[model samples]
Target: MSTGRDITALVRPPRSYFVNAPMGNNFGAAGDVATQSRILRAVLALAVEARDPGLILDDVLQWPAPFAFNPAPATPEAIAKQLRK
Candidate 1:
């Protein structure tokens, strides 16, 4: 459910909404207010409803079309090594 492998989920803490997104734009696509608000509301609703701890809301926003991103190189190790520099 996590976008970038949230280590915190191992402990299962409060206010955790695991989504399929990048680091910054966790809720929805940047500049897309409607989607953002909707995501926020969903999380808020979970927060309000959740009584016990260890609540991880794993949800995926149904994007209209494919949300595109910069293509990654075929090999991750090569790109990761370059980024480390």
Candidate 2:
């Protein structure tokens, strides 16, 4: 499965599943079992049925919740504090 289409395309695997999700949350959102299951099943089914060598399947799924970037802490100590929590 790939979250970065550019990188995946360069590597060129036999068959790949591409998800338009965050780098880490590639299978859907956190705690969303239904979406995760669907993505897994689709990939597995494609693996079995795909005939082409450089086939790339784009997932129609989107993140359940809107995404926003959180501002980073100004200081290293503040970043460490958040991580230690």
Best by lDDT: 2
lDDT, candidate 1, at 36? 80
Write the residue-wise lDDT of candidate 1 on 1-85 in tens digits.
2454457577666657777766567878879998788888888888789886876777766655655557666698887988989
Model 2 regions lying over 4 Å from their true place:
64-85
Write down the TM-score for model 1: 0.60
Please give the lDDT score for candidate 1.
Answer: 0.71
C-alpha displacement of 74 in model 1, angstroms? 20
Please list the Cα RMSD from the true structure of every candidate, rounded to 1 decimal place: 5.3, 5.1
